[model samples]
Target chain A: MAVSVLPQMKQAPEMNPVERLMAATAADMARVNDLILDRARSHVDMVPELARYLIDSGGKRLRPMLTVAAAILFGRGQGHAVNFAAAVEFMHNATLLHDDVVDESDMRRGKPAARMVWGNKASILVGDFLLGQAFMMMVETGDIEALGVLSAASAVMAEGEVFQLAKTGDLETSAADYAEVIRAKTAVLFEAACAVGAMSGGADAAGRKALALYGLELGNAFQLVDDALDYGGQSGTLGKNVGDDLREGKMTLPVILALEAASDSERAIIASALGKPDATDLEVHQVVAIFNRYDTLRRTLDKARDHAKAAIAALDSLPDSEMKTILADVVQHSVSRAS
Target chain B: MAVSVLPQMKQAPEMNPVERLMAATAADMARVNDLILDRARSHVDMVPELARYLIDSGGKRLRPMLTVAAAILFGRGQGHAVNFAAAVEFMHNATLLHDDVVDESDMRRGKPAARMVWGNKASILVGDFLLGQAFMMMVETGDIEALGVLSAASAVMAEGEVFQLAKTGDLETSAADYAEVIRAKTAVLFEAACAVGAMSGGADAAGRKALALYGLELGNAFQLVDDALDYGGQSGTLGKNVGDDLREGKMTLPVILALEAASDSERAIIASALGKPDATDLEVHQVVAIFNRYDTLRRTLDKARDHAKAAIAALDSLPDSEMKTILADVVQHSVSRAS
Candidate 1:
């Protein structure tokens, strides 16, 4: 459990990429956290209680940090970036809460899932509450264009969830479909977070586009690494069991590639294990054996490296700053975590 | 089954209040409906399917009509009222979708609830989608003040729901608490609907205040009538069974008043039925008998009548117009439905 997501980065003599980024944006992110917790307050006790349970549950606040770091990278924001950062985090956490309910997850961040403790209905409603607050925060920023970006992402995220739901356990789900799913559900928010942050910093259109593209590619790499880690990491290393994605019928890159190369007998073993909530450990071993044989985990990591490279390349237009170096390192760490 | 909500108005041989209002705003309401249906479209099949299932379900588009009617009263929206009206409807349907999931109701509007058909997870996510789309519509209007009104209402409505959830079946919930709950959960949206419509319509400060007050009182009266009808009306009268509020442990005004007057034996019976989701029909009848003994339904109707009167009184500041008359009449009809 003490093993960080990017253990190698922790071993680096310099500060970890995530830690360096957090330190760079520490002041703004602190303000954003305050704004988030303040907005989370409501006369209805349960609204705040359920919301803070997840907001305070040690999420690394990575999305909001990106917003803040992007804002600082561009220069001093007019101060609206703090609100946008908080809004981004709220949107991310809101999706997570609802996702846990949809996936019927029992744990999150090494603790009981919000749905497990509060029930699915509460989790769902509270998720709606957080989303409402997110919009409220965005409106406070008074940037209609930024609001459009976030709202569009919000809609696409829900679509991604539905598409994923429809494709659950289907071996026929293409690599392209998985890409579309992750792009919508995960990358859109990241793209919005950085784009809005750039806007708050008075970045011109070109800068905003560059930051958005950077966030998008980083998000892609982050998710690809996460998918790979689900298969390769030790239990509790990722706050879930290895093969959890397979058990949940998620069509991650590793599984997609493994299925592509699997022989008929190996395919049968994978099919039986995929999407079976009660998939057994031996079945998982059999699937992993095939995954190892085909080196699909390495292929997945390779795909993540490709995304990480593109993420850094997307930052080529940005002016040099200490934050820029950390941002590129963050991209590298996103893929390195899986390795 | 042929009974209309405003039965007394129907007896007058002219168009009933809702019909009159809808006819008055026919052109605008049509545009609003088109916008709503247009916004509901998505590449994700279930997103539109579940969203449309509820939007197309049989219920008067009362909230959107109120928005359009309010806008027309002041007559200066420049077509933005259509957007606000569509946004209002989307918000209302979004809440209904989530409410059904939280309450676990099997039916809505004479058909199976979307949750029953599509399951709770889809209902929740799709509801979130509608909410996101609602905000998008509102932002597109470029009305910043109006956006704030709706977003604030959005947060308050969620808080209201949480309060209602917290107080469910806690028999000692006071009349004041019940009043706050309904005001937040039901009336704030109504107030916002009209206020935003008036804002978009360019209503003067005095006229906007009057419309907001009118809408709030109308909302209060409408919800009180609904609570009374839940116990007093026949099955299917309100797209649900009699005593559903009791079975769900909703502390509606009628039940709140009844509990205040119940004898110890009656109180014990009500307690057993309250929040007991599996309570039988016989149990409902027993609770209703006690409600009859206390005249709680009548008292609830009387309270609604008081609010309806206040609603009409609030509209006195509005200059005379057909829309003004119909709006006042709509207030009366909101209560008369329970009669």
Candidate 2:
């Protein structure tokens, strides 16, 4: 009999791609978690409280995972990967705190956003607190070159947010411009995280560059799928409702693609709803129809697949290892899971 | 007006304390200024645009001035001090941006606050950008020890801010707590700025420690005067009305001292106005009278003077030089000018 087919499949030896990596890296991830919790403590009550509130939430900790995984694949050095992994998580969480405030989001990780609970001032200040701590952690390693990689990424990430802000709802945003935004905002940190993690693990320059590229492509694919999801994905997958990016005036990839191919009347329909904070579900439905007509969502997924392929391809030159395959599958699955 | 006494006094050779030091370090300060303006340029238009807006405002540039002065006092190293000086200014400005967002300040240097102009989101993100730049600059120097100094100071500064936020309007906040808050929030940056500058200039360990102590005392004196000025200084001195600290519920030295000596009725009056955002000027006047009754303003200023003297005395071990003497006077003037 069709005896709980879904539960049976879940119990199969082959687990979900992400869950597999989670298991493979579980010990190191646990250590990273410990490092995160330890570093978050502070004399100021609000500092630790707010930091842990966000850090302990349902975040998958993918960036830190990538950092730790990359370090393990190289397998060298005095185990600075733990600190670097924690720092990467802190940077990612810090950005989320600021992003929620910037986007005026009400939720994060399917829970009330930190800004919603603590207010914008606390969120911003806490974000700065996290960043300061991240730098301190990085400095404690006494690895100047690796610190340069991360700091450079931090600057670029801020530039990206500003660039996105400038282009928000500007309907004139191009694919090239959209690529730059996601690259800076999303991929650069990923690139730096993996690169620095590898550096700390004593990876050679070539190996470091390969991991950096792998992370960059994975991040691009990940964010491209994220933008696509806002137009047409499961209702609750994004922590916010569908079309959240459009409502926030963000010029995501799908919107840019659909805008490029739309006729004047269709363009008016999309532009009318874009960047309107009060955009209704009906308006979102209408935008999705336009996206459907243009096949922008499918095309966005296709683009994501391309990046995922490139991310996997980056590992071709490296010696094959169990961790390397998991890293490649993780990159591919980062996109597929959004389907 | 018989002899136009004001003009005659203005024409005297003696310059304003800050101005005299500015002139003494004009070349180095100019180099720092150039570096600041140059590094502040960014591809993200909002970054450079917003950074320049605040950087060009008529700040006294006191922090960077101190940084360069400390560097020049030692007079060595093909001048990493310029970068450190710029980094110091960036750190100070970064704090100012976040502080305005936290304080909801509407004005800075007689201009609308960055948050007021660009909104809190821009101010916060831009502040992060500046800090990222600050760290990048510090890292570029490849001096891990100094980076450690600045990073440690940054963490303490954020912690101090959180501590102050926690203590806001709490009548139980103590004199020791207030000192800790000020030392962390204000004095630590000053300490780090001078220490790093001294290090960049090739100062010995003893010399570095001396500059650090000197800067810490000077910063304590500077903030003490700033707090005292909030209660009793001239118009426009704080870029806001007198007793702002009271309206904001800040437990400044004057308020703490008054709380200790206050009669029940007087304490009730202060409790009513403290931390009340809508506190009336009349209420502020009442608090000031109580402060006057206890000589708290004078006592606060006296505390500032003592710290300022200690700051100068810390430099006594250093060899005599024009820059050294100017630095000593600078500390004294930091307090006397408030009087």
Candidate 3:
């Protein structure tokens, strides 16, 4: 008798690093999200309405997840991590709202920006409201050291934005300046997030420092990948139009490197598109062609990979754990987004 | 012998209450100013440049003086008051920068606004920087209770501004709504400044509550007078043009009162100029005439006087001191500006 043919065993696809981290920290993230939504409420209709629009918009919530993951890595149950995570998210969203207004961005998170739906005045006020709420949340935690870390980070972030604004469209921007800008505006917050999470998680000084370093390096890699993606990635993936950084006169590393290597004629083409609000698609493509010709995008991505490696190296001293492994892999996934 | 004619002794001019408060808090205020200037410094040149412009532009520093004076009133010498005072000033200036952008006013403190010189984008970013620094200073103090007070006040102030924006040019805005708006936007910061100062100054729970109540009423009176002065006071003294509130469609007390009393035609005249950016001097005058006919300006000032009295009454339980007297008189001085 012929044996019944057995159904072929199907293989389950492996989860990406971010997805794995999310699943591992899902319980803590739910509490963090609850705190975030609760704190975002206001008596004023516009405050919450505008805030909800931004908060509900689909963001990966990666920063807060890092906070949770770092806490779990230290074997501490969620204590003040929930509050710290929520505050970190609020600060991040606050900056995003202000940045959109500053950049005159048309879209955010695959949706029309809050400023587009509400006016710029509403965007500014609500951003201020969110920032105020962020500090209030931190104050509620009664963790003075953590508060200091986050507050200092907030100041440095603003300084970074101001410095970046000052250097916009300037061809003379150096790699050093770009490094400083990214460190101040982007990496510091990440460092603060991880450091504070570790503090709340009962990590000792060494552990906190390691997490901070990991966060800083990861943030650097994340921003570099973002800069590369602005030129090399698709618009659908970016949630923003391709070439936006170039159109906004932002001197991202890709543009800076290209400007350094291009001929005078090629530099002129890039300049015409740089900071020109009305820059046509053709002009943007011409500039991108120059970037590709010099392999600046690839060079930028390579620099990102270096930071990603550094980020993983920061965790080497920690005892092996699933959370630690996930955190290291997450850095790799962040850099790999450009591919 | 001819009697020697003696020059008549000239009586010294009486110092206004504000002047008296300034004198009493001079030493502490000097420290506060130093702290303000120091914290305002940033590696980003534009940050300090814009911050200094606003800080040095000669605001009376009333809010910070209240803080120092409150601390001194409770005989706390000057521990964290200096930092709190500096932070209060920064918050005020931050709001002013943002308010100017929201109002699109060309002048501030009788000079071109920082936004005019630096652009709205700079004003926004610098305001953010100052706000971040404000929190940083508070965090440095390590007084979580004080920080909580200021941060909660910050959230309320933002809510107030958002509420005010929502009601802009809405004729149906009631007097109660106006009260809520002023309290949230203006009075809450004053209340917080005094309460925090008292806390830092070693005030017990009862003493802190008294100072807070005094501040809330004083703030109410202060804002009411400001609303009246926008119509009744001169541009030179107000540091802002007359009829600005009306032109911007701010539903201040006078406008709200006038709207309630107006006939259809009179309301029509006011409506034509309300929120009209290009509203001519003639139109503003016509609206003012209606305000005059309705006695709305006087009525508004009368309400301010009531609140001023209430403010002084709140201090009745506190022991008499020179600072207390100065604080009481300052409330009167603030209201008298409308007259």
Candidate 4:
């Protein structure tokens, strides 16, 4: 088949909120990236290799960008934001590496997981290495308050994961349980990242609290959208297989909502594929159809929009700036991904 | 079978070096134990369940004991020693949990490993929870320097594990490589534990360095004896199967020495079992015969003795006290375990 080319007028690409935030925080993020690679170096070649592979892979680096942006919003960091931002990213990556092993996941950020390339043992050890490095960086900053924030968040994140693991595949998992899981596993880090960044930039108590709330709400929106995308979006857009959450037996919000509204037979159809790792595409579609009947995806996205609105509202008390506008826009864009 | 009872005369039980250290540090250790249990508590039942199972299992809390002993030797510490000691134990337990997962181990401290009871996913998350709690405890103490010591040690320990994993099953692994592995994986934590304890206890630079060196050499001796006992000890004595090191393909000093001295046929016999997960008892016996022919176990124990001596010698410049004497005796006893 021959393809025909048509002449088109040139236009400048419009930057998304995340892209705008990235441009705004480019200098600090560059430093964060440099610090990440530098601190990731190890004499044990595999440590650096595995770490670099994951670090260089296409993560948006949004968490660290938030750290930098929050710091810029307060406008007083004496180069400490770079260290905090890098440490946050490392903590995030460490979690990702361990999460893959726990979930026995094959792909991450559109590439084969570190576990696949280096085996589960290496993945576990390197994840540990990165976590250690994260703490070490925090210690170097000699900001014990910030260290405490991150450490407490770390503990809560692990608890969230354990709680999520315990609730996996349980049909009775509630929206409340899902909220707790997302809060612990995902939003807590976001809260810590922004809180610490604000602290680094010498924010007042109110400013710090505002950024923390903003981050927490934004994180909720981020994860809610992600869960919705697992069923509503294409695999290409999500960088993972569609219905993976179902295959993994995760009682995500959509599934939880569908179960609550499902008929007995409809529930059975969804349950047939809920925790079955080998569930076929047809089985997933069956489950998705049930979800559609209940309008769970739209409901989940609606919940995400609520969180995004709250996230934007959090910045109302802070002084208005370009970064602030972009941050609010980022929250809106995050929830829009599914739609 | 009938058992016979014999009349026994009453006698005072002599305390071993470790027992003496434990007794001397009992007050501080009580607080440490309390802290450990308190921190290990999580709302997630499995987190506490798995963590408690591992924590309550019968392993001599030697690492934390060293932390307390080092602090007492300096004659100072305003309750900070308890926190440090608990943190050290948590770090050790975290490493053990992850190690069991990475090694696919079934037994630990004569009990089924945590992974066996709760599965690898729970083990990994619980391990992370413990590590996070450890840092939180350190942060609570407001001692950034001590935190730095443990954090750096944690990184080095992870690197050591990665390096050891890379060297597994390699017959050409040398004595130097084995030493590097032990120092990084085992000795560094010991060094950090003692060093941090001394710092918390207000020790001078000289005193801190002395404790660090003492701990490092003791750790080296501890690991060497452990490796040797894998070949020479009864399963009951070691709390694990004999020949476990060989079965796991660990390039310990004994294996390095045996390979160095083995002939072509002998090397083949050893190779057949090295890294073989299901290596039979007969295969282990054949390999042990080669080790015996080379006196590798005795030589390995001899190396342990050398390290024990150096550990004792590291305390020479310190002011003599009951704790110091017990610390020296503890090193001797650690190396004497294989014999």
DockQ per model, Cα: 0.63, 0.63, 0.70, 0.74
- Report how far off residue A315 is in candidate 3 (Å): 0.6
Q: For model 2 chain A, give the 10-residue run with minimal summed lDDT.
A: A1-10
**Which has the better DockQ: candidate 3, or candidate 4?**
4
Clashing pairs in 2: none
lDDT of 4 by residue, B1-339 (tens): 001110121222498888877777877888889989899998888988899999999878999989988887887566588899999999999999999999999999888999999999989998999999999999999999999999999989999999999999999998999999999999999999999888988899999999999999999999998888888756897678988988999999877898998889999999999999999999999998888889988998899999899999999999777778789989988887777
List the candidate 1 regions with Cα displacement exceeding 4 Å.
A1-13, B1-13
Q: What class would a CAPRI assessor give candidate 3's docking? A: medium
TM-score of each candidate's B chain against the true B chain: 0.95, 0.95, 0.95, 0.95
Tens digits of per-residue lDDT, candidate 3, B36-101, equal: 989989888999999999889989999999998899889774489999999999999999999999
Model 1 - which docking category?
medium
Higher-lDDT candidate of 1 and 3: 3
How would the candidate models be sorted by DockQ, starting from the highest?
4, 3, 2, 1
lDDT accuracy of residue A80 in candidate 3: 89
Q: Between prediction 1 and prediction 4, which has the larger TM-score?
A: 4
lDDT of 2 by residue, A57-157 (tens): 98888888888778877874667887888989998898999988888999898899988887777787778778888998999999999899998998889
Give one digit per residue, the lDDT tens place, for model 1 in A201-256.
88889999999999998888888888888887556766888878889998888888
Top DockQ prediction, candidate number: 4
Q: B201-275, model 2: which lDDT tens digit per residue?
A: 889999999999999999999899989888874647667668778888999999999999999999999999998
